[model samples]
Target chain A: MPSDSSPPNRRGLITLAWLWVAAPLAYGVYELVHKATQLFTG
Target chain B: MSSPPVAPAGWSRWLVPPAALSVHLSIGQAYAWSVFKPPLEAALHLDGTQSALPFQLAIVMLGLSAAFGGTLVERNGPRWAMTVALVCFCAGFLLSALGAGTRQYWLIVLGYGFVGGIGLGIGYISPVSTLIKWFPDRPGMATGIAIMGFGGGALIASPWSAQMLASFGGDNDGIALAFLVHGLSYAVFMTLGVLLVRVPRTGDGGGTASGPSGPSDLEGVQVSARGAVRTPQFWCLWIVLCMNVTAGIGILEKAAPMITDFFADSSAPVSASAAAGFVALLSAANMAGRIGWSSTSDLIGRKNIYRLYLGVGALMYLLIALFGDASKPLFVLCALVILSFYGGGFATVPAYLKDLFGTYQVGAIHGRLLTAWSTAGVLGPLIVNWIADRQKEAGKHGSSLYGLSFGIMIGLLVVGFVANELVRPVHARHHVPAPREAADAQRQQPA
Candidate 1:
């Protein structure tokens, strides 16, 4: 019966969900950026 | 099991993307399989072609299985599909670990290619429709968020995997251990998706999905998967996807070699390190395009965006062919744009399907359309590889090696551009009856 309302604990879970996926994605991006910088370096 | 539990009232729609990402990011490791090839070839004493067999077969199985398992996903739900994908994919890795440890190359092929490929297929399409349902307000962005993970998967897997190989040593035991680690770690990561995912609650849940804001340019009608293939719109989109993918993937598959060849005879020959950088850069562009251009499609319309991908994309190919070596910066810019279009072409198609067919069975329909990708996977590389091999035989080097291939890709783009032009809304005869009408008719008949 509620619509789009998140309890504090549920909000924490949502944050974790996003972070769970985002952290790996960010790590991948970091590695890619490190490699990609070499194109101009040479 | 029956379908996974639907979301309770007030359950956040946002949870769905991570679930999709969990599956996609894991399966996306297929892109990084090249990292395993040299090690596998060295340890197993196989040729380059022989080593590539598992990745190639995995792609083939991805297409076939996705096309086949789509309806099952709609039947069993995302949690079930994710779990199955986790099992099959991880099991494939475990089997490959066993194979590598034992020096049985065939087992690696069976494990990684056949078993894991099914996981790739099923896992890939599992969350697509759910995302569409959740964010009908922005279906393009919804799908893009998850599908982009498939492109980005390699970025994460490639470096971590290389480090693992570097640390563990690239011997048979090392490779087996790496595969074991991947299987176990991915099992844990993907399980999060299975647990987090929930279908949207239907009917008197007090909260409705509410937003169905697909493109208004079309008739905006519903068509089941069966009726979808029967329409000309499907085949036209299929051809459009095929040609677009072939052109893009052709370059992607041969990227490092192609860039090196393009500049080999020139004064500014690309170094090996720079070439690796170029490949990494392309991966970035590819990953960015999935989220960026697909989200743009939500605003600009799918047909209009395909116009950009195919139309501008052909011009970029022509530029690369004629003047690629003239400037390194220019060449990189053109190639980057082309790769982005390639990635964009992939991410945009699901929304395009929703536009043409509506979301009735869009996942199944998308699965069927992926056969184009499977076809392109073979055709794209074949066209480039065959031509390059012939050129090598003739002692052709540098940009000349790819001139003919580029020309052929331009023609493919033209064919795709024409196919995009041919797309129109589905005809009224092909429509599934509106639910209210079907329900009304059923009531009259039963009495």
Candidate 2:
């Protein structure tokens, strides 16, 4: 966990905060893996 | 307890509600996606289970994004948060449109699941803590007003999406066009929230509780986001929400297919339009659950309302399992009530957290706690879909496949019921003293 007391690196922290953008994107990618594989097999 | 500190100068508190309304309305569209399910499945020649992917992914993303974004929303305030939500939500839709148009299923998942999910999470928490700050006196009503927007989003989105699809026609081109429109429309709609929201002045944060309008003003207490997570009550309530949501979703995800399947071999099989009506009815129940049952939580207390959700919800599943297709009205009525409780479960939980934890960082904590919801989102659909799949392979037909699914839901709810009963007040060790209290304690300690 990032310490609460550190000086707020506004840009860096904002980037980190929004990095959760990856989670859903990653999950979406993960969920469709089988279909992608099926495309090749077919 | 002392009255919350007064607001700082020049902050416009009232603007917050509209900001909340914007996000809730847009994210709420998730409830209405089923309106488009049939045409998409037919157009794409996908299986019933495959058709459910986009909606399921959207929901899972909703919980995940919300859980992850909870704290950032607190630090950045509603404006920044709302902006993030708008961008992601719109982008998600656009991506999904591209995916649909080209027939690449992965794109739909990318657009809606990852992109749109972030929008759901950020939009969800954007106004939560700020609203609490604005209406310290009436946390439930404040949160309810905003959360209700989410519940009602589907009510608006369902008819609107249906009409759009109807006009556009059900080909891949049409569906993709509809998604593009949804993305653009939501972007426009959510702009209202971004422009209108303002944090309350720091000194003004006290005493505006809204609810059943009688003696139990305590219905909407405020708990800070951080303090809430430290308490066992938060986790216990988290279990209650996950269980309640899972139960309702299990039925909801399969409502149309289940109904049609149930009546297929029977004398009074459901027709196409009536099945459409069934989906609409479930939407109504889902919307009503957010407003009706959540508002009711003010009078009954959070625990008691959850008790109703879990206990009554379990019985509703049982009725469906034992009775089979005996009475359509009974099934519909029970399903509606259960869905309402599910919606209520979502709308009222923030208020319940307020009552237990106090509003210091309630929004952030609420966001964190939403991980439970994310977990339930996946678990709920997986349980329902997986069980149904196995049942189909076993040659189970119609409502019989649902029996095992509903039975599993019942067991889950039972465990949730126990968890609710176990919730108790926090001990002193977990309590972080307010700034004033900490200052006073320091003065009294030996030098």
- Top lDDT prediction, candidate number: 1
Candidate 2 wrongly placed segments (more than 4 Å) = A1-42, B1-15, B33-57, B95-108, B165-180, B202-230, B261-267, B392-398, B435-447
Looking at candidate 2 chain B, the ten consecutive residues that score lowest on lDDT are B209-218
Candidate 2, residues B59-150: lDDT per residue as tens digits? Answer: 77777777767767765666778888999989999998998899887898788877887888888887887776666555666787788778
- Measured against the true structure, the TM-scores of the candidates, in listed sequence, are 0.93, 0.76
DockQ (C-alpha) of model 2? 0.02
Q: What lDDT does each candidate get?
A: 0.86, 0.72
Interface RMSD of 1: 3.3
- RMSD of each predicted structure: 3.9, 11.8
Interface RMSD for each predicted structure: 3.3, 14.9
Model 2 / residue B288 / CA error / Å = 0.9
Off by over 4 Å in 1: A1-9, B203-220, B434-447
Top candidate on TM-score is: 1
- CA lDDT of B310 in candidate 2? 92
